[model samples]
Target: MKVTESPSYSTPEVSKVMDQSRRFIATASDRPEDIVEKADTEIIGLALQMLSDGTADQVIIVTNDIPLGEAAESLIPKYGFTADQVTWLTGGELAPELKEDFVSEFD
Candidate 1:
């Protein structure tokens, strides 16, 4: 699990419960010097590491962030992952053009 430190989100609390299912929680730092502010960056990094290290056969990303999902999809193929091995879940299944509706649900 990837957790972002935010005033609005209780990441630590969530992480404790999620830890039972997954071993580690990739926590993000609140550094003003950082380029990226989202947890997606850490999530993507962990996913890539899992693939390259041969720890996971496939990586499934469950994010509402469109750019992060698209960026992850582009990089997964470089690690020898096929289309079937890389999956994105944004709440519901929808066509790429209709994904905007899916994203709106989070808003």
Candidate 2:
């Protein structure tokens, strides 16, 4: 699952989490674990990192999967991401739009 929001809604906690995630992604090793299951933390870190990196001028992610949805919601508060910084796209299945879940702002 993914969300799309403006920076205005970003919270301190979210910013901090995003920071950690970004750092992980920017410097990840080329090893298989770095890009795969061995690095769940690294994946989350990379996802958030991409969001702040501006990989796309505009982006949105849509998903209704319980694991992803719940985790995303929980992480928002824990991370302090604002409502706007976070978004939910209601749907029955994952699709191309959801691919933007990894939006990044890095050059």
Candidate 3:
């Protein structure tokens, strides 16, 4: 979805978070021209917004995308959130029980 189409994007805080995520991804990527995807950034942006708005004490981002996870980790601290305040998990790192459930759902 376009960033503007996000229901939460109408809020100033969400909008700011989204912009930060986009900028970070652009500058951080080696191939800046190839990093045009915004969905992953939007997910990170919403997670950051929740932390900023006090909606969540901590946020855990579970994704197989390594770059996206790294981006979230790097950007979290820039927004005044500490490492302990957020967790990034890859599919391989998921607990056995969650992995079973995850697989079952897709199957």
| Worst-scoring 10-residue span by lDDT in model 1 | 20-29
Best by lDDT: 3
Residue 9, model 3: Cα distance from true site in angstroms: 2.6
Error of 2 at 20 (Å): 13
lDDT of 3: 0.70
**lDDT of each prediction vs. the true structure?**
0.51, 0.41, 0.70
Which residue pairs clash within candidate 3? none
Off by over 4 Å in 2: 1-44, 54-59, 92-107
* Best-fitting candidate, scored by TM-score: 3
lDDT per residue, candidate 1, 3-101, as tens digits? 433222234322322231122212222223233434655565556555555667787887666555665676556556687767777645534655655
Model 3 residue 74 lDDT score: 78
State, as a TM-score between 0 and 1, how close model 3 is to the true structure: 0.67
Worst 10 residues of 2 by lDDT: 29-38
Q: After superposition, how far is residue 9 of candidate 2 from its true place, in Å?
A: 25
Q: Put the candidates in lDDT order, highest first.
A: 3, 1, 2
The full ranking of all candidates by TM-score, starting with the best, is: 3, 1, 2
**Which ten residues in a row are the worst by lDDT in model 3?**
98-107
Candidate 3, residues 44-101, lDDT tens digits: the string is 8788777787878898888766667777887777788999987999776776565554
